[model samples]
Target: MTGTCGSCGRDDEDVVLVRRLYVTPEAWDTPGKVEQGDEERWCFVCRTHYPHEELGQA
Candidate 1:
């Protein structure tokens, strides 16, 4: 699979994989809510600048 960096927008072979979670307004109001999301690949530059557990080196 190929994708661009979430930050630098680079689609190089080496990049970071990250997922985004989005919750509906109603879900947010509930005590227990499930989030829907998507995954994205980020460039090495972004991974270096912003490192997080959710972002995996691809």
Candidate 2:
């Protein structure tokens, strides 16, 4: 099964899946290496939707 965005249907907008890339300790310590990855999509609408977080701020 693939991850899907709740609002839209885009693999890139998948709020569930995070395409992570793991590297060894040494590799991680290298000059330039990626430790994490980008997001997978569930919907296309995710591209247009804005993330709303509430921290007592507007």
Candidate 3:
């Protein structure tokens, strides 16, 4: 699927599926690249921003 990456804002066909959990304000009080509880397709570059464990990759 073609869509813009919520992280890098890249509009390309090369993308990977990413999953994130819903966190409350207290959990994400710090300023960082935290996803707001949703699954989205992100490009390879943007995908690298997230942790490998969270991606369910070995």
lDDT of 2 at 56: 22
lDDT against the true structure, per candidate, is 0.57, 0.40, 0.57
The Cα RMSD in angstroms, rounded to one decimal, for candidate 1 relative to the true structure is 5.7
Question: What TM-score does model 1 achieve against the real structure?
Answer: 0.40
Each candidate: RMSD to true structure?
A: 5.7, 11.0, 6.4
Better by lDDT, candidate 2 or 1: 1
TM-score each candidate.
Answer: 0.40, 0.23, 0.46
Which prediction has the highest TM-score against the true structure?
3
Q: lDDT tens digits, residues 2-47, model 3?
A: 6677567878656666675443344456654434556666677766
lDDT tens readout by residue for model 1, 1-58: 4566666676654665776554344555566544645666766565556533464655
Report clashes for each candidate as comma-separated counts: 1, 13, 0
Candidate 2 lDDT trough over 10 residues, lowest sum: 49-58
Task: Give per-residue CA lDDT, model 2, range 1-58, as digits (tens).
Answer: 3455544544543354334344444455576444554444333344334342212211
